[model samples]
Target chain A: MGTKAFWLATTAAVLIVFAASRLVTNDYVFFAGYVVLQYVVLATAWNILGGYAGYINFGTSGFVGIGAYSTVVLHKLVGPPIPVLILVGGIVSGAIGLGMGYLTLRLRGVYFGIATLAMAIVVQTLVTNWDFVGGSRGVYIIRPAHVPFIGGYIQYLFLVMLVLAAVAVAAARTIERSVFGFGLAAIRDDEQAAEVSGVPTLRLKLIAISVSCGLMGMAGAPLPYYVTYLDPASAFNLGYTANTIAMPLIGGTASWVGPVIGAIGLATIQQVSTVTISSALNLLIVGVLLLICVVVAPNGIVGLVRGKRRRAGRGG
Target chain B: MADDLLSVDKLGKRFGGFVALDGIDLTVRAGERLGLIGPNGSGKSTLVNCLSGTLRNDSGTVRFDGNLLNGLAAHRRTRLGLARSFQLPKPFRSLTVVENLRVPLYYSVNARPGAPHLAEAAVGERCRELLRLVGLEAKADRQPQDLTQIEMRKLELARALAAEPKLLIADEAMAGLSNSEVDNILALLMRLGDRGIAVILIEHIMRAVISFSQRLVVLVAGRKIADGDPHAVVRDPEVVRAYLGE
Candidate 1:
């Protein structure tokens, strides 16, 4: 489908999913579906830099750590009742993303990838050692007072994440249509040609990374509040980084629906596997999907569908 | 703006101790057609790289339209109306032919302050117009991989033209094309120059070089051997021995 039609359908689907989610009000269903939305937000955020711009960030976990910590610290002082806390997560993560991009944006391909991985390691290490937020022991989040009749606390978390997911997807769409988006696409194609075309490439790249990281951070911010717990290892869990990349890659990088499809599909598989099979096997499923996408359908599912349509269109 | 659009003073680039370009001084007046010809490792591409901001000069200054262009990034220089085509065509593989035009048109139009922004439809139309100029409009919706050698070269020219550049550096655009194809490309570059776009043609094809260039420059071992009339520069003993190898 074309971009405009795809967006309209996505909006309708989101509303249906949200309303349907409200029907299943148990703690488990609320928690599991909310987790999927979190993945959707994080994965789409990652795609802003990785998929559309062709910049692979292995430091996604590092940005998540920043987001989680920022939310934990802020909520501990005040409370989660303020809805603006969600946006704060994005802003904080985006700032760190800017710093990371400035230092590593010039690095490309694997060298840049390795540098970002190292950055994640560094952040994880620092947070682990720092005692202010419990260090190795982790931070304790006292879940804030929930206003009655706004549904249960878990439902509120779901809505917060749904809106965040919406913002992430909307933001990505806006960037994809803008002039800066064209510059990133050019940089992805040929840096030299882009430079001579007058793209202000570094500025554009930095902006993309910042926006991407900020959204990712916001995705993680509520985790500490929802769970009422935070530790360095869980907050900086490297698995989150891999999921962000694998989901988008499997869904199809650079397309509007790529990350969403990848996120929802992978999260469902993980949820089913966690219940019936083994929690450890969840990653294995994602890994297999990633490998299949890389080997057979490098463009991901959306790409496959679009390719088939185009081929059929041509044949007719 | 000065009558000369670009002036290079003692520009140089080095890979380790091996100098790729050395003390190359040159000037191109507005709307000039200049041919930069050299042998395989003679630094034609290097000069273009430095002029187009792909490489930072190890020493010296590059000024465009009386503004210092050295130290500015490549795209920024392009915004200042300096654009170059790659020796090998590198169109955005995922984008359609017409979409390729939007990149430079937006890059040039957005990076400047006074330039008006075109709507998406206008941008798409302008892209088609550029493809038409280079005779690639019929294939506007096709991907770059769908293009043949001459068509790919045409796409590259269309992309460069989309920048609305004051000076366009066409880097070996006609290479690996048929003789008729070479003439077609020559006709296209001449048309661009006719529209008052300054052009620097880097080519190994001597026939095309002689026909397209109003002035010629020869580089050998990272240094300029001759810079003057195309006929004399090609015939000069040092230039002929070092650059032309005839």
Candidate 2:
């Protein structure tokens, strides 16, 4: 489908889900649903560079941290609306992404992976030292008692995240089918071959990194409002890194739908397990699921299903 | 020299202390068919790399169609109409046979000034034509892994052709093929030459290179030892001593 049509359909679906959630009297659904939706955005954003271009980014939380801090700084200065804050977050993170790509894209394979991991640590250290966003002590956000139309602040946050998820998924789907996506796929398969074949490899990679980081930052922009107490440690939590990478790997990295499916499935499990058991086991569950994915479905759930279908077709 | 489509002046490359290509001077006229041959570890592949901008030459200059090609990136060189197939045939593993041709068409061909702005349908049409040219229309949807070794080589050649290049370098494109398969590739290279595309065929298969090349160039120990009529160059004493070993 064309991007416009896909976007319209996704928006319609999100609205319907939001409308259905309104029927539930309890506020807990929105609280948990917000997180699941947040991963949906994070996973989709990460996949743009990590899955599509075959560059593994271990610093997802760094981009998210940038977004959250950008929001914190903006709130301190002018206290802009969430949308404006989100825009600023995306732009700042995208510029950093472009800079990071320029400095590190020449290093491939494990070296590139290490550079991104180190980048996350660097970002965390920087945020810890910077006092504008309250340094290591953290900052508290007092949300308005009642949201304009959504009634509850939590519900409003949920609705915003839902919209962002729709936007992220629609964007990914569009890129997956475009000429630009084909160039990325070529780069992923073989950088040298792609270059000799006339693909502008470095330029395409930088664009991927910028877009991926921008969307990730957008996902993080609303975090301060959601949690009320935002710290450098929480903003740059390594859990964000693990979950974002896990979602795409578990769902399938080849297509846009893979990361969305992975995020929704994995995040929902994590939320349910958190309530029924303990939050400490959340990372354990992720590790186990990732292990399963690596062993049994190395290409993820989508790849497994596609393999079965192809085999059945051949059999027939 | 003015009519030369590609001119290399004293091209040199070294890997640490080992010289790969030393002051190699060569020229190809428009639509010319030239065969480059040498023993293992000689500089035939290295020369192709320098000309195609895969590896930068430490010294000397390369001019293609009156444009000085020094320090240009590989993709930029391709945009300027120099294309080459790898010796081992590096096909995009994830892309299907036909989509493999689309990369060059979308990037190199369409980027040129006054080139037709190909819509999706036009791109598909062009991809189909390329697949047919390389006799890969039957396997258009198959992954590169599913193709035989010879088929992979054909796909490589077809992908290079997709750029609409002025000059093409086919590096051992028929390495593992049977005699009939080698003849097929030779005929294909000859056909490319007929279309006003200068071709440099680098091959170890002596018979195919001699039958296909109007002129032959021999390299030995990082230096050009012979360049002349194919029959005459083969009989040069130094070429026979260094390469033919007869």
lDDT for each candidate structure: 0.84, 0.93
Residue-pair clashes, model 1: 3
RMSD to true structure for each model, in Å:
2.0, 1.3
The list of candidate 2 runs beyond 4 A from truth reads A1-5
DockQ of each: 0.76, 0.87
Fraction of reference contacts reproduced per prediction? 0.80, 0.83
Per residue, candidate 2 scores C-alpha lDDT tens digits across A1-316 of 6667876778789879989988877889999999999999999999999899999999899999999999999999999999899899999999998999999998998898889889989999999999988999999998797888678888889989999998898888878888899999999999989998899999999999999999999999999999999999999999999999999999999999899899999999999999999999999999999999999999999999999999999996
Query: Which pairs of residues have clashing backbones in candidate 1?
Result: A195-B74, A195-B75, A198-B75
> Using TM-score as the measure, which candidate wins?
2
Instruction: Provide TM-scores for the models.
Output: 0.95, 0.98
Residue-level lDDT tens digits of model 2 in B11-72: 99999999999999999999999999999999998899999888999999999999999999
Error of 1 at B138 (Å): 0.6
